[model samples]
Target: MNAPKLRWVLFTAAVTFLIAVLLTSFFKEIRKVDTLAATLDKRMEELVGEERKTQKLKQDISYYSTPEGISRLATEQFNLVRSGDRIYKIEVTSQDNLQ
Candidate 1:
């Protein structure tokens, strides 16, 4: 073959190899970016769930700081009642007790 023709063939082969290598590298980088994006989406969902829990806790804290909420907690937890409230009690006996 002529010298010029041989040089041209060599240059074309080199360029093709270089392009193949670059495309492979770029495909790997694209896959890594996609994986990172999926991970970020999952982490964002977890953050949103935690934020909701924090908001609920804040609401509970604010309610418990009020007089009405305090009164309800005292009544339910301690069975204590305010003045001017009436109390009633009932007793039941089973058939076995009579026997």
Candidate 2:
């Protein structure tokens, strides 16, 4: 083969090898970015759930501050009776009997 032709072939082969190496590294970087995006998505969903829970707790706090809610809590927690109200007491022998 002529010297010029041999040099051209060698140059083409070297360029092809360089391109292949660059493409391999590029694809590896893309895979890493995809994994990071998936992890970020999971964390974003968790944050959304926590925000919803926080909003629900805030609403409950607002409700519990109302007079009706306070009265209900008092009756349930302290077994409070209104004026002239009769209270009934039941005796149970065993847990199964109560059920």
Candidate 3:
């Protein structure tokens, strides 16, 4: 083959290989970006869930700071009652005890 023709062929092959390598690298980078985006979306969803939990906790704090909520909690947790409140007691026997 002529020298010019051979050089032209070699240049073309080199360019084609370079393009293939670049395209492969670009695709790899694109795949990495897609994976990172998916991970970011998952993290964002987790953050939103945590934010909701935080909001609910804030609401609970607000409610528990109120007098009515404090009274309910006191009654439920400590079995406390106001003045003049009546208390009742009941007893039951199990089947084995009855037998």
Candidate 1 regions exceeding 4 Å error are 1-4, 78-99
Q: List the residue pairs that clash in candidate 2.
A: none
lDDT by residue (tens digit), candidate 3, 1-99: 646788899999999999999999999999999999999999999999999999999998999999988988898899999889888878887899766
| Candidate 2 residue runs with Cα over 4 Å from true position | 1-4, 81-99
lDDT of 2 at 56: 97
Taking the tens digit of each residue's C-alpha lDDT, what string does model 1 give over 1-99? 646788899999999999999999999999999999999999999999999999999998999899998998898899899999877777998999887
> lDDT: which is higher, 1 or 2?
1
Clashes of 2: 0
The TM-scores of all predictions, comma-separated, are 0.72, 0.71, 0.77
**Which prediction has the highest TM-score against the true structure?**
3
25-97 per-residue lDDT for model 2 (tens digits): 9999999999999999999999999999999999988988999778778788999967787889997688776
Residue range with the least summed lDDT across 10 consecutive positions in model 1: 1-10
Query: Per-residue error at 3 for model 1, in Å?
Result: 9.7
Better of 2 and 3 by TM-score: 3
